[model samples]
Target: MPFIVHVLGFATFAQGTSEFMLSGLLPALAADLDVSLSEAGLLVSAFAVGMVIGAPLLTLATLGLPRRAALVGFQAVFVAGHAAAALVPHFGFLLAMRAVTGMAYAGFWALASVTAVSLVSADRRGKAMSVVVAGLSLSMILGVPAGTLLAQHADWRAAFWAVAATTALSATAVLLALPAGRDTTAARPGLRTELRSLAVPRLWRAYATTALTISATSAVFSYLGALLEDVTGIPERLVPVVLGLYGAGALAGLIVGGRTGDRAPFGVLLTGMGTVAVVAAALAPTAEIPAVVIPLVVLLAAGGFATNPAVNARVFGILGETRTLGGAMNIAAFNVGIAVAPWVSGLAIDAGPGPAGIGWVGAAFALAALANTLLDRHLTHRHRRTTSRSAPTAVDGARATTVSLYAGHDRPL
Candidate 1:
């Protein structure tokens, strides 16, 4: 509801554009850098590696600083990284720049969600988080395509230049609009206390759920182009249209999920994961039918992403005082899924059933995540019952908090 929250959302939009724009420019980048396609592909991996490492590390390092300052600083570095990436003559230098860019993005990514939610009340946390998260889905639907068009119409370097400019603009906006405030009180915990906060098994369950859910979604999407052409008999030209529909579905899902998540965290997550598994399994049998498969693709995106806000809110609710570390860890888990899912699916494709079978692989992952979600619920309930029998500390109260999606209501959220 705050103007600053929207500013943070804009920052996320800029960051998400940079994160996904590279996917569309790899071919042009490969040609310009005089490298093979596979080599150019490594840049994506490089970014993921940086995100996984930078998220928690940078989040922790910045804990004592003002939230507004950290945000502006991160975006400034992100802009510089893209600008450097655009000017680098060699592929290695560009790769290094992208890694740095990823680190900057991770810092902003972790903090922005927290900053957004911090401005809202407990009942509205999911909605606030959703505003920030929607920037990512919007990037997939809009920014990536625009970047691809820029690369095709101009040079790939032009795309990077545009990204850098956009990031700089976002940084300026954040600097001008975001208020300077420490995210926490004067008694900031030491690094050891922060590390101890992450030791909660319930938090790890949330992390695992995030990782596995992302892995499922990424596995299917990473090979979607191939699946569309090779298996669905759709021409290559229409793939973007189909993918665009998928993006729209994701945005819609995110909106609905955010609203539902505020009401029923675990229920929404379970339902979303179950939908993903069902859609993925159905895709395995229905890939040959474009009409059926196309809708399924949209459903897949919707189902997979609907869990984002809920899972994020759950982590925030459970972490309580440790929210910063918890948020960073969750972001890292997302990147872990992004990095791991495609690799696992690639292995599956290379081993046997070809590209179409990626659906089954994705389905298996969704099912596994569904199982994990069940475990998380069971643990939450068990912890709640245990804590009620004895005096509970702050951390124990947080751990025992009910994160159930439906709570007690059988009616829809």
Candidate 2:
């Protein structure tokens, strides 16, 4: 509810726009730069690689800085990267620029989560974090579509220039809005500490759940446009509209997920993953039916995104004060899943399979995640019970004695 949240939202919007706008402009980039589509695709791949490296590295390096300052610095880097991309004529130069952008983007992305949590009481943390992340959904819904339109009407360079301008504006806004203070007490846990924490069975289970969920969703979403055309008989021009619907569904899910996360994170996660699996499977066979296709696509979008806030909350809660690093690591896990899913789905598609293969793959991933979630719940419950039973009773006895002394009347009420 703070004005700073708006600034963070806008910064996230700019980051998301820059990250996705390239997809729409890929053809223009390929034609103008005399490169293949594959080469153009490297722009995306390069960004992912940067994210894979940048998330943890930047979080670690900037561990001591104020969140506001870190965010501002990252946004500045993002603006510079986009500016370079707009001006660079060479494909290799553009790729490098995009990679730099990804690095900057990762820092901002991770910081945003930490900032959101730090700004609010523990009770509102999930909703606060969700509001910032909702910027991502907004980007998919509004930014990507608008950027694509800009590229179509003007040159693709226009899109990058627009994003650069947006990034600059967002950077200025964030710098002006967020309070200036450092959190020196927050953990400076090096990679060794982080690794040890991650080695915990419960944490690994969380990672597996996150990975599976992302793989399931990305496997289908990566090729959704093509799938719609082949299976749903949607025209190329209408694919964007359908995708927009999907984004809308995701936006709705984000809001709902945030509100529900506080009371029932695990429940939200379980229901969301289960719903995603069921919807994906159902949609597989009915892809030719427009009515079914449209609703199912929406369901898939909702189910996939609805789990995000809950997952983030759970992971951060598990890591406590070390959330920034943990959040970034979880983000890296999501990206890893994104990288793997498409390849897995592409192989199936290439083998003369239909879009249905995507559903099967997604379902399998969801089931794996579900299994992990159940195992995690069991372990957590067991741990709680064991701790309750094994904790020294003297501590409780001392508390009782202290209470009796304070009451003075000393008759056991």
Candidate 3:
């Protein structure tokens, strides 16, 4: 409940706006740069690529830096990237700057995710995560739309200029607010030790689940406009209204997940993924019915995103002591989903089923995520029983230790 945590969210909101604003400006950007739509589309992929690479790379690069310095420095780079992007006359330069902005966003997110926890008690980690994560959802609901309006009313470069200015303001706020402190003392373990911690099978399982859970919605979301137009037969003017409905569902899910995830991580995961699986599979069948498909899409967003906080909290709990690499790796996994989901869905559409195919593809991903969650629980219980076999009394102690783990008894939550 510290002020710094909310400040962290404020900073996230600014960066998130920059991250998603590009989608709305693509047409204008393409025309202005004298490029094709597909060529301009590469900017989104460029950002995703940078995020996937930068999460761990920058975490290692700034391994021992203080939290405040790292955050402010990252924001400075993000601002510079956006500013440079706005000023550049050529498409290549803009693409490179977008990638640079993504890298800065990734590094900032990697540090800030754990930093939010450093200021809170174990019991409140979920609340902290919720506050931090809510910024991204809010950006989709609010900032992206505003940026799109700006681009329509002015120019695409104006949107980029606005991003740079807001990012600079948030960086200034972060510099003024976040106290100076080591990013992570536990990370004092050298690079080799930190890297080795990531080899754990359990961690990779968590990473896989994170990627799958995220991909569930991201795939469908990428093709939503097309599906709404070609399949649902919705008018172009009403598309934003439907998108707003989806964003509302996403924000609502994030809030619910953040509030309940700490006490019932598995339950949250199951319910959320189950909802996504159901809605995703139903989307194609219901596409011809607006009333049916619209609500389903909203539920799809809600269900897919509800698992986010829980999965993130689980990763933090599992790697409580050696979190140096976990946060970065989890972040990398998120970008992996973001970058790959749309591509996979696009392929499915191109292959045969058309826009409706995105539904089945998304459902497959959601079901896989659900299966992974179940497997994670089974493996955890089995591991606990195996570890408790030393002595009868050790069983109680081991159970308590795991209970503590779930309660975030360890510091790196």
What TM-score fits each model?
0.87, 0.85, 0.89
- The deviation in Å at residue 338 for candidate 3 is 0.5
Q: Where is the poorest 10-residue window by lDDT in model 3?
A: 404-413
Q: How far is candidate 1 from the true structure (C-alpha RMSD, Å)?
A: 4.0
Model 1 lDDT tens row, 1-413: 98878887777877887776665566577788898544665677677778888899999999888877888898888888888777775899988887888888989988887777767887788889888988888877877767766777788888788888888888888877865553443445667787887877778888898999888887787667567767889864566577677778889999999989867878888899999999999998888899999999899999988999888877777666557777899899888887777667767767777777889989999999999988877767665566545535766555434433222111233
lDDT of 2 at 5: 74
lDDT per model vs. reference: 0.78, 0.73, 0.78
lDDT of 3 by residue, 1-413 (tens): 87878888888888887766555566567678898544665677677778899999999998877777888999999988988877776888887887888888999998888888666776677778888888877776777667766766788888888878888888888877765653345445678877877776887888998999988887787667567767888865666567667777888999899987777787888899999988999997788789998899789888877888888887887766567567888888988887787778767877878878889989999999989988887776666556556435866877765664553312221
For residue 73, model 2's alpha carbon misses the true position, in angstroms, by: 1.8
Q: After superposition, how far is residue 366 of candidate 1 from its true place, in Å?
A: 0.9
Q: Compute the lDDT for candidate 2.
A: 0.73
User: What is the Cα-based TM-score of model 2?
Assistant: 0.85
Consecutive 10-residue window with the lowest summed lDDT within model 1 = 404-413
Query: Candidate 3, which segments miss by more than 4 Å at Cα?
Result: 22-41, 89-91, 181-193, 229-237, 392-413
For each candidate, how many residue pairs have backbone atoms clashing (under 3 Å)? Answer: 4, 0, 0
Candidate 2 Cα misplacement greater than 4 A, ranges? 21-45, 89-95, 179-199, 354-356, 394-413
Error of 1 at 98 (Å): 2.8
- The candidate scoring highest on TM-score is 3
